[model samples]
Target: MTTAPGSTRNETAAIGDGLRGNAEELLRELAGPAARLRDDQWVAIEALVVDKRRALVVQRTGWGKSAVYFIAAKLLRARGRGPTVIVSPLLALMRNQVAAARRAGVVAATINSGNVTEWDEIHRQVASGAVDVLLVSPERLNNPDFRDQVLPRLAADAGLVVIDEAHCVSDWGHDFRPDYRRIRTLIADLGTDVPVLATTATANDRVVTDVAGQIGTDTLVLRGSLDRESLHLSVVRFDDAVERTTWLSGHLDELPGSGIVYTLTVAGAHDLADVLTSHGHRVAAYTGQTDPAEREMLETALLDNEVKALIATSALGMGFDKPDLGFVVHVGAPSSPISYYQQVGRAGRATERAEVVLLPGPEDTRIWSYFASVAFPREHVVRSVLEALDYERPQSTAALEPLVELNRSRLDMVLKVLDVDGAVRRVRGGWLATGQPWTYDADRYERLDAARTAEQQAMLDYQQTTGCRMEFLRRQLDDPALIGAAPGSGACGRCDSCTGIHRDTTVDTEAVAATRARLDRPGFDLAARKQWPTGMAKLGISLSGKITEGAETGRVLGRLNSLGWGRRLRPVLDGPDAPVPDEVVQACIPVLREWDWTVRPTAVLALESPDHPVLTTSLAERLADIGRLRNLGTLYLRPDHPPVSAVNSAHRVAALYDSWEVPDLSRTDGPILLVDTLTDSGWTFTVAAWTLRRAGAPAVLPFALATPT
Candidate 1:
């Protein structure tokens, strides 16, 4: 046996003997008395406890990966080691783990964004040796104060380091997160005697190799079959949104028990939740936009069967432990088979049978392309960000937005990447350049993009595959059990393809009509931007603070990504300039009529669209004629100043600062209706309204054919 550094062979053997003797009893304590460790589980526990080496376990979701870690942690603590530090990925996962630890008679505490007020106390408990396991989100690993002060102490004394959902540590994984890269530093800081465990259920061969290498060269890997016997997988295709909704509305209750209905976009979740509720199904929309507290409540609600399902996006994917979850329905397929496997794995973890259905939409590819656009920025963009940062003084994200072309979310992602690369450091106020020379890995990014495209193709293949659905997924994940299986012998005997038990695609005609009517109904409120983005003056604009005279709450016919009116308006907004469509005109009339405006507009004004001039002008004229309002001249784009192409808010506002030449509106009596083809960022309307209000118009009411959600 190999002895740990600075330990004699006698000591190592003594520790190994103690671990071997006590492991099963600890497992019984953690799991129920009747529950016993599987041979692989014991192998993993012995590796961490006796061998004192890093191990990577790639098993199915409900395969008692948590039991192995919790039992190992209890044994390690009993053997005079410090507490275990688990770098968990999600708040939901952390909550579940903490509860599981408590049930095992192990004391556990979590430090996350949702529990800021408890952090100091938790830190105190850890320092006082009162906490056995500390669960922290990967993002917390890079917090400046925690990194400089708390992490070093924890790393120095931690007995076992666990990375839950460890696939996230690999860029090749479906959900790659830059924050997870910080785990490399944490692992480096620990003593060689301290053991490490990285657990994930959805890693392919490439991801497993990548993550194993990152953990250590001597890491042990325990991989098993990726199939879930309880899952009965199938795909249901629909030609249009109305047909999909009709089928879902008619058949949602027939699916086993309360479960999740996944959507590709946030707007789709909200829209589908509304549709489901209207059909008398108890449901709520949960997305990245959901508040943390509300998310906790909704999770509990789902656990208690308070609602039929939480119409959710990928936000609710990992580490949610509802063992009895009966079904998982995807309204649109994710971009990769690995992602699909992870999502559908949430069902049937502790149940006998669960239904997994994918209602693949034609719009799924378009949504995937939209998400793919936010991949790593070009080399010049990274260089621009680095050059804009001050080496001594920190610059907040808002302060840098004016100097860079990336939006808030993309900018944050870039900054985090740079921070991980040691090119920048996030301090108390914001980010500071570390004077570290950094090379933009163009080849690496290109390779990643290529891999993503391949994964997308694999997802498409999964939807169309005729062979065993479970076997196809297992092969996609490079499951070892399928290596030598006879041809056509790996079928699960459960999926629709295997059993010839496809769901009836027939949706009721009346349900279809009602869904179509609901989808066609237009209009959503466009809340005005009340505060100007900071750092505007640095971009040569003097604006800051509240915009008292900005446009009032506006009306949108539909969102471009919305289920309703989005399909109809995309052509008008994205296609070449032409006469406005009559159906679009009819849609606008109802929006205007339903709008509970304090005072109706007496004049119509159109914002000049260089790309869609004919469409904008025709719509303005038609509305003016119909409303019997004066036709105010258009707000023309100033000469030599083309429309703003900047993506971030501050630069967008700066480009629009003096770009518009508003016609005289001093003679306009009532509120003047402002027209635009689409609204993104809401900056155009705010700036134009400021110009018009300064030019003596009464109140400005912004209207648009569509806006992005």
Candidate 2:
């Protein structure tokens, strides 16, 4: 057999023989001396260090994927090869990798969004060969400075390239990040002799194939059994949010040890965390909105077992490593079984008999639909974006928002995808069109959407399946070991279905009442939009700078996605137009009474809600009567102009620029209460309030039945 391109027969033999001993020593340093490298781990390391070939390792979460790379880095570095470059997905993962590298006597430094100040020093260390491993987020790959100035040298010099959570590289992956596509370009720039490795615990057959094809057709695939004996899986159905929270509050302490409680929404996390805290459990909320410093502190707290669990969103899913984590309870099921498997895999990694429970809610599909809406835009939207961009000039996202129908986050996602596809370039100022011909790839996107839908159905099936939970997940992932198992021997005999044992589904009456009361307590501040979105002038709107006359801080009865009022409000908002429900009207009374406004409103006004005219009108009239305030007539929209669509702020404001015909409020005194059925984007309230204030109202106090979360 011929040796790899960069190695002679003698060198290959030395790598095979002497390298194993060194790798074992490094593993002992990384893990304790009692630890040993599994055969598959050593196989991957040999493929990388000995054969200098690309490899993809699909192992379970606790299988020490990190060890294979760290030991390989050390072995390669010992041979005077350059430092390894790791494309990590999260800051939490980077921190763990860096600390683990130190245990192995490898110098590892990370440069990510959280450490902008340390980047220069880290770069200097990498350049001086003082760092054995450098971890960077996938987003850093496309950073203009990094892509233009730093990546070429790093790619040329990297001894080994590792993509952790490599399933994300594929659109077929549940968490398909566009930035991971940039890795293909980086790999293309690498020398033929440089070895590459990609690893993930959650890839299905499609995702694995897609990632392997992207990495290289000749890549070595080391796939192991996707089974964890320590996890006992179960699904508990809940009648409502109150029951779910009550059950958690009643049963949290009974869990094996500190672990995670996941919610689908940030608001839900905070809400559940609050409920659990009130029940005398120590918990903290973690989400994308969590500050980096606070996130680090919370992560440390969890690792130290100071907190019972972290109530979190998907932001906590990918890289959090807690070896003895006792449980993972999902308040709502994720959109797919692949995502569910990855999340539940977090528990029982190092401990025996960890609980993995799913409390499926009726509202889960609604939340899933909301997330699905943010996917790749329609072909028309993409073409519109391309047409609006300038070929030579860089335009910020803010500048382009008014010209497009997409929201900031969705537009940013589109731009990133476009940049990765060579249709646009993200430069110093912002984005520049490359004038490159680009196709919409409708077939690929349709397939992805279909796969997502199928996965969602599979998740629902998993929840309702009577067979072994682990076996079902394995089948979904197409685990290779299933083929070798004896017929009728696939069951682990640990899951609720297999063992015929399930957690208690009953919630105490008092606990349920308390949870209901807590959730029913409504009112979240609807912060006023203070600054005008940039580029309004381009839309023929003269608005700019601070809004001298705008709505004061507003009050929302509750979010449309809130645990308690959400259940009441979703139907009212989503259904056909009708008078405001008595329940919602009653809910608003407490909100107004509890609002800490500086001055009481003397008059009430309603914005024209074409979809819910009766509801908005009835709400305004009822509030005026209840509060004993003047009933200012409705603000009618121009006949030709429709209600502003829920696009970005700039477009919304422009649509509402001259659309509302404010009623005469010159005779009104104190604050004018502006009532609308729903508040999304908050531009309607701002523009309407600005119109009211300009029309001689002293102040505008915006109140809404609900706001979309």
- Name the 10 consecutive residues with the lowest summed lDDT in model 2: 483-492
User: On residues 1-709, what C-alpha lDDT tens digit does candidate 1 reach at each position?
Assistant: 4567799988877876677668777767766788777888888988888778899999999999999899999988988899999999999999999999988789999999999999999999999999999999999998989998899999999989999999999999999999999999999899998999999999999999999999999999999998899999999999788799889989999998899999999999998998888889999999999999999999999999999999999999999999999999999999999999999999998899999999998889999999999888999999999999998899999999989999998999999999989999999888999999999999999999999999999999999988899998998899988888874678999999999989999988888888878888899888999998889888878999999888988999998777778778887887888999999999999999998788999999999987888998899999999999999968898898966899998888888887888787768999999999989899999989888888898899999988877
TM-score of 1: 0.97
Q: Kindly report which residue stretches of model 1 are placed more than 4 angstroms away from their true locations once superposed.
A: 1-21
lDDT of each: 0.91, 0.90
Compute the lDDT for candidate 2.
0.90
**In angstroms, how far off is 548's CA in candidate 1?**
2.2
TM-score of 2: 0.98
**Candidate 2 residue lDDT tens string, 1-709:** 2386788898877758787888899999988989988999988999898778899999989999999999999999988899999999999999988999999999999999999999998888888999999998999998889889889989989999999999999989989899999999999999988999999999988888999988887989999999899999999999788898899889899999999999999889988998899889999999999999999999999999999999999999887888999999999999999889999889988887899989989989989999998899999999889989998889999999989998899999999899889999988899999999999999999998999899899999999998899999998898999976663377889999998998888878988998999999988788999999999889899999999999999999987777888888888888999888888888889899988899999999888887889999999999999999999879899888865665888888988888877777668878989999888889889998888777788999999988787
RMSD of each: 1.8, 1.5
Report the Cα lDDT for residue 117, model 2: 98
